[model samples]
Target chain A: MNIPSKLIEDAVTEISRLPGIGKKTALRLALHLLKQNEVHTEALTLALTRMRQEVQYCKKCHNISDGEICQICASMRRDKTVICVVEDIRDVLAIENTNQYQGTYHVLGGVISPIQGIGPEELTIESLLERVSLSQEDEEEPIQEIILALSATMEGDTTSFYLAKRLKEKGIKVSTIARGIPVGGELEYTDEVTLGRSIMTRINYSTE
Target chain B: MNIPSKLIEDAVTEISRLPGIGKKTALRLALHLLKQNEVHTEALTLALTRMRQEVQYCKKCHNISDGEICQICASMRRDKTVICVVEDIRDVLAIENTNQYQGTYHVLGGVISPIQGIGPEELTIESLLERVSLSQEDEEEPIQEIILALSATMEGDTTSFYLAKRLKEKGIKVSTIARGIPVGGELEYTDEVTLGRSIMTRINYSTE
Candidate 1:
């Protein structure tokens, strides 16, 4: 009844459930799918099924993993005593792509958002504290540092503040990732890279 | 090391194989599918698998069907003596949606395109002629009409001309679906209601 076949229209309906796809674009996608062979469709289905089935969160640090522990968590070559906490798995991947952080990661799943009913209970913060404290029981040396790798959004700042207060009570060194202009989110709209350097130079958080 | 997760990147690669989907939009689609629960993913996979596995073209008309005979071919109410030849299965469904004709269809798979290397042998032209001849053998009334429902493109016009010549040799009255403007493609963005009226007033094609 629509611009294309019933099969095409049905495919469009399924695709339209995505976050930003509209009906017209959905139709375009569906028509495209129809033209492809079974191999292509099978590959897509397999990827989706694998993403759901293979990927899970690390129990110790909460980073995304194909196993119980993520690559970073299992790697003895990295600095296990330094943990970088982030708001989501996406942030972890973004940080990992930079190949700079030798420390492991903790993914909070989401920021604390009162409107969306997300709170401390909904996050992996408790597990993080437990992991940091696990150092005392195992003779692996106390967690020397914690890096707050949350976004620079309002919620991210609030979450970092909450995390900082809690970690300070337990007597661990804590620091936040700098609030400099993001690699892509903007910089001369922020020559703020220079301004950020000034802030880092003037930093006065406890170094322990 | 790409802009998105590896699993997401893999899914996008698969989805981009569809007819018109590009890499950017496919990435968005893959991300959307990942965000959904197991049930949504499972449903989509099932639909995709069924589309490839369960669907087959009808022996009689070439329209997509779950059985040897398409739904239209199996329907007793349809007039067997009038066969509307269409460019593809999509066109058959589009006409069926109109509910204007009681006749069955014969899908040509595609129009004659020398540029694309599609010729009469590549189509269902032989099968169509055999079907007409078989009707005569079965003591059924001779096939009275053959309608060419194709797009108003150059290839469509050429195909219609060739098909009309073939059917007229067999003594069947052949016609084309009216073309003043498309129902949706644009007559300054046509309404289907106006398009329907124009179909009723269509002029006949002359060999002259």
Candidate 2:
């Protein structure tokens, strides 16, 4: 893009490395930082650096934390026996925002993607198993259910299948989130696969 | 959106400060950085900080530069007597990319916008006038023309009009880029204001 300065070009190159940001957008962002006060730029850089260097992974769930354990893992109000497994930290935040699930979360860090050269070993699958086994050994409020709340993708399914097999041997219940058309989705626009799955797994209409 | 970690939330807040980025996208980006190798995040932060702190503005034209003078302003091949004035650095980059304009540039930093509390004093207008006067005093390659290449907005027009009035006294030609339907733009979909202006400023057609 014929950047005028080496500094701006260097900044743009690094910013464009991020997911979803293109070269043009990177240039815009870099120019924005240039226009802003130096303190603002320093603050942004400091925050990102601290987050990268200081942010810890919950040994039990692998969720991002400021300390040894995540807030959710340390909270007494949450259902420690029920763990919702997710592929990414963003997924954990998404579920937390819904406020429907009161259980703890186990961030898989990533799903099993063979095409991306990612295997089960590369993820936090072993930590999850260790968490469950540790709880069982303690015999105090042992993990009763593990909810596979991963995405509706091939990688998600493969990871869930693999985890379910292992968790079943440990005598713990392993289940998956339901797949259906979204609540506000129209029947006409619904994809055939989702519609078919909804029909096959339809629940009986009984008011409690 | 119920971020899991204070460090993550801080990073997300800073990242979301960028234009066009929202809270959700910020969280996603933060999580992405967390998953990536630490070196990548450090590189991004270092580049941005260095760019913000080290980038210099050309004293002659106010364009971003690594040294005292920008590459365009310092190059002897560029027509220094003919200057194209623009509102921002991105505009300078845009004109440079066009490969049509051989003249040097004068970056006004921003257009006059009363609503935003930005006036002539807030821009590089005084410096531009000073530059023209300095060249006139030298009596060598006096500026023959000053092109107002600002955006076709009310503020851009106001700034151009203000500059034109003062520049006319110096006996130098003042011109603005033509405002009309964009290249390949459909006449049917063109707005009335632009169509009317185009018709009023229409020139004789001839193969030059």
Candidate 3:
């Protein structure tokens, strides 16, 4: 039998569904919300509600947005020719947080994983191709680059290879970001300076 | 200047307003949501909205509920004569997780903290007293017992003392849970078995 009230139990169940939050953590968060003043709890509830109502996918690049187009796609300052393709919007935020990338992003939504039943058609690959075809104004210039900034997992590799082949057929220069230890994730498995240097002197992927 | 889109920034800002979440963690959670499927995202958002719209405080016990009375207050199996007084609904969950307590709960909403300007008047103390006065039956068996299961903190102690005095005039038996060292909070400062022994040989407080 359930020990907590149905309301509390529902909140805990929802919280536990989040990544990294276990049953104990969910209970803690639920209880904390309960202790808060009605106004405070109301604000949290409103934010959660509005996050759904307001947020949407950018029509152009498939990145997260509050409108028709993502900020990156809408911005005139970003390099339109150099599109960094990633697995999800989290990668968009990760690159954005680095303050190192100036190109716009294309969120693939997820990687192509046969094991997971995710194929090329399942992603926004068609939209990406359509966006790449938008070079009609300057056909001679061609798209300068398509950077594959996908994660360094097996699925990410397979997806990158698939994307590279598809983009290469359209005569676009496709390049995968170097595979190395992540800044986060598991760290004790890797030595410190080696991981940092791997990031510094990364190699490009090539069929040769 | 804000680093991300205004709506995304605003969402993160609002999420960080919760008790333990910081800006970094809020960003992580927001990015995680942005990466999730729209259906999953909508579920979380809806849960938050429903929490505010549907959930209410139990008029009788001050505990959280989706109706006028919480399920604990509504349950027939729970012992109504015995009340377990706690600092918050979180404490209620903690006790409930043990599966040892069969009595219903009364959430204080918070402990007494002079520094934070929180006192007896700010809590559900008056409601608790009213509950006691009205609960007495024709048989005159008295409201058997009240368990003061507040935390072992200084503020918790102060609140228990204040509550004990208030209940004593009504001729109700008030008891407090024992305290010495916590189960896991800063264990390096405590001896091994003392904490274990404290849990084994708990003494009841006699509010005479």
Q: Who wins the DockQ comparison? A: 2
User: What TM-scores result for chain A when each predicted structure is judged separately against the true chain A?
Assistant: 0.82, 0.95, 0.81
- The CA lDDT at A205 in model 3 is 78
Q: Which fraction of the native contacts appears in each prediction?
A: 0.36, 0.94, 0.31
Worst 10 residues of 1 chain B by lDDT: B1-10
| lDDT tens digits, residue span B105-202, model 1 | 99888889999999999989899988887886776656778888887788998999998898788887888876666544766577675577678876
Q: Largest TM-score belongs to which candidate?
A: 2
TM-score of each: 0.65, 0.97, 0.76
Instruction: Give the distance in Å from residue A151's predicted Cα in candidate 2 to where it truly belongs.
Output: 0.4
Candidates' chain B TM-scores in the order shown: 0.82, 0.96, 0.81
Candidate 1, number of clashes: 6
Query: In model 1, which runs have C-alpha deviations exceeding 4 angstroms?
Result: A1-51, A74-83, A97-103, A111-119, A135-208, B2-16, B19-43, B76-82, B98-102, B110-122, B135-142, B152-165, B178-208
Q: What is the fraction of true interface contacts found in candidate 3?
A: 0.31
Which regions of candidate 3 fall more than 4 Å away from where they truly are? A1-4, A31-50, A54-56, A66-69, A74-76, A133-137, A180-208, B1-4, B24-47, B54-60, B65-81, B97-99, B133-139, B180-208
Give the interface RMSD of candidate 2. Answer: 0.9
lDDT of 3 at B136: 70
TM-score of 1: 0.65
Candidate 2: where are CA atoms >4 Å away?
Answer: A206-208, B206-208
Interface RMSD of each: 3.8, 0.9, 3.4
Cα displacement (Å) at residue A105, model 2: 1.2
Give one clash count per candidate, in the order shown: 6, 0, 0
